[model samples]
Target: MPVDSCHFRTKPIHRNTLNPMWNEHFQFTVHFEEMCFLRFAVVENNSSQTTAQRTLPLKALKPGYRHVQLRTQHNESLEVSSLFIYSHRTEEGPAGGATASSLVRFIQVCCF
Candidate 1:
């Protein structure tokens, strides 16, 4: 997904099993959390077309792990998987820096 026109991506993990684990981490510097929305897409490695996609608001997200029911663009049920999200704000910082007073939201979407 691209945040504010800047693309950020994670490396794809290939496994023979049905359940593949990727213990990875991604970090981003966000300017406006309230105005931000997440766009998630799942595409086949051999194809350019997206099989599943979702655009979600940052404020609607919650911390910790939970199951997210995915749907295609047609609104049909796609899959149900686990997701984990975490957010942190600093108490003191320079101007324009993230602080507790200033609003900042974090969202993590992981499919299991």
Candidate 2:
């Protein structure tokens, strides 16, 4: 799967396996989660031909491990497992403290 114009990519898993374990960690610096989306593609490793692709909204996702049922271009169903974690850093003052008002103002300025 790729996100944000191919800026992030997960390691490929083996083909024809009932259960594949990637055990990989991917980190992304997300500024606008509302506008961000995830693109999944199932491509042939050797031929490089895309067999299936799907786009999903980021904000609609929930945290923790889950199963994603994807649809191919031909509208066939495919199941995949995934884990999602979302985190953001809060801006701190010179004294290294973040106030509630400051965080609210930051969200208003950025999200609105």
Candidate 3:
């Protein structure tokens, strides 16, 4: 799965509780929505390894809020670990008032 401007990171919650929230927002331009996977990862500060992660296939996503279940690096599900997010897809024609043959699509994601 290929994505444009795909890499994004959120600020750490810094709290000691099991349920942490960042309320981060991110956007990405995807060329092919059917062949792309939206991947989310949690990493500690100054560490390259991911603490937990989840991947969602764009083709299966519905426009609305969703609770995405997360898993450990070894692909084991973590109880009560998930992401609450809202995602929507928008389509636009070519820039500069050009023809509509080439449409651009953007996926806007908001996490809370």
Candidate 4:
């Protein structure tokens, strides 16, 4: 996707757990998937401070379930922090003699 950046926060924080299963689905439409980067950040509810985050290029991700590593604000890897997610990419075929295909897809992510 030809997106510079997209940000969103998970809702209704699951209390008393390091691993939170969000089961949330997100979709985006863009011209080129290779130019997009997906960023996920975890924040502390009370203080609104981001605890961990990760950024990955859309083209570098493989379809299906995967584990993404998380890091601290300083860019240091948080040894045990990661996100379990499922990504599916679909391109619509040219319709009604249209020359360009529609780029749309869904990505499901769960936090840890």
- Arranged by lDDT, best first: 3, 4, 1, 2
lDDT of 2 by residue, 26-100 (tens): 444444556767665656666878776666676665554445555677767656633233323333333566654
Lowest summed lDDT window (length 10), candidate 1: 82-91
> Which pairs clash inside model 2?
none
The better-scoring model by lDDT among 2 and 4 is 4
Worst 10 residues of 2 by lDDT: 103-112
Clashes of 4: 2
List TM-scores for all candidates, in order.
0.63, 0.57, 0.80, 0.78
* Model 4 per-residue lDDT tens digits across residues 1-112: 2253556666856665666777777765545666677788888888889898988887788888888999999889999988888777666545555444354444444443
| Residue 2 displacement in candidate 3 (angstroms) | 6.3
State the lDDT at 56 in candidate 2. Answer: 68
Q: Report the Cα lDDT for candidate 3.
A: 0.79
Q: Give candidate 4 regions above 4 Å deviation.
A: 1-5, 96-112
1-112 per-residue lDDT for model 3 (tens digits): 4435478878767785477777878888877666788788888776778888987788787888999888998889988898899988888877676444466678888988
By how many angstroms RMSD does model 3 differ from the true structure?
2.9
Identify the leading candidate in terms of lDDT.
3
* Count of residue pairs whose backbone atoms collide, per candidate: 0, 0, 0, 2
